[model samples]
Target: MVLPRNRDYFQIFLASLSPMIFVVLLLAELGLEWVYSLSIITLCYLASFIFWFKNGTKPAAWISKGKLHIRDGVFGTDVIYKDRLESMRYEIGHKRAVAGSNAEEAEMHILVIKMKGFDEWTLPIKDLIEHGPNLRLYKFIRDNFYNLKLVKK
Candidate 1:
């Protein structure tokens, strides 16, 4: 059983940064007309959005050999085995989180996995939205861990 990584977050991250990126480009060019710069930026943003929409999300993960291998868009390839799997939980939004967090940074259904003798981890669900719906992922985690097959790769 190989699970694949979702790359929807790549587009979301790019979209969020596009405005600042455009402003930087516009300002870097000396004496450029604001209107012209804005136009260029707008076009770039549209093009980038279109490109991502057309080819959004990557399926590059596997859960075979008793290990979960994922190609994270923000990080990189991450591999964790069954033995390391401890437990799983959900992240509370900033407002509801006991520790508190920025509302914008908090998203629902952020999967948190705990490992034996290790820190907890988050599986970004917002990034997976573009690839497809992720309701099934929760179920999968529940069913797998419920069986307590945490041992060895």
Candidate 2:
């Protein structure tokens, strides 16, 4: 089964703006002229499109042949085999806050997978839990993995 990328384009575009805004503000504070600041911001915005927006387009995850594949970036994918897994965990907490909201935050559901000889891999499954077609992924993990740990807050 494949879990396609669930991130929205608008969200990615907004996320890219944060750094651009900061750079422009810093340039202004440094007494740069309006033309120079505009040029710099334009460059930064274009870079964000190339790096951030492009990177967000990929499959979120997929399962095949007793292995789980997680796509993390433009050039990176983490593969977890069922046989090598040491422990599996599901955790919920305030690890990330909602964008542009100071007092309101969303609960992040993270799937923490620990393999025998590798560092633990944590994938935020908030989108999966809320927007997935079904709970097949959750059920598959629960049924296949042993020593499953669930932590809720």
TM-score of each: 0.41, 0.56
Which candidate wins on TM-score?
Answer: 2
> Cα lDDT of all candidates, in order?
0.53, 0.69
Once fitted onto the true fold, the runs of candidate 2 whose alpha carbons sit more than 4 angstroms away are 64-66, 71-78, 86-153
Q: Candidate 1: RMSD over Cα atoms? A: 7.8
lDDT minimum window of 10 residues, candidate 2:
128-137
The superposed Cα distance between candidate 1 and the true structure at residue 34, in angstroms, equals 26
lDDT by residue (40-104, candidate 2, tens digit) is 88999989877877777666667789887766444567677888888888665535778899987
lDDT of 1 at 89: 62
The TM-score of candidate 2 is: 0.56
Model 1 scores a C-alpha lDDT of: 0.53
* Clash pairs, model 2 backbone: none
Q: Across residues 1-153, which tens digit of lDDT does each residue of candidate 1 receive?
A: 434444456655576555667566666676677887677667777776665554344445546667765454433555666777788664434122323644434243465678899888766544444222544444454464334222111
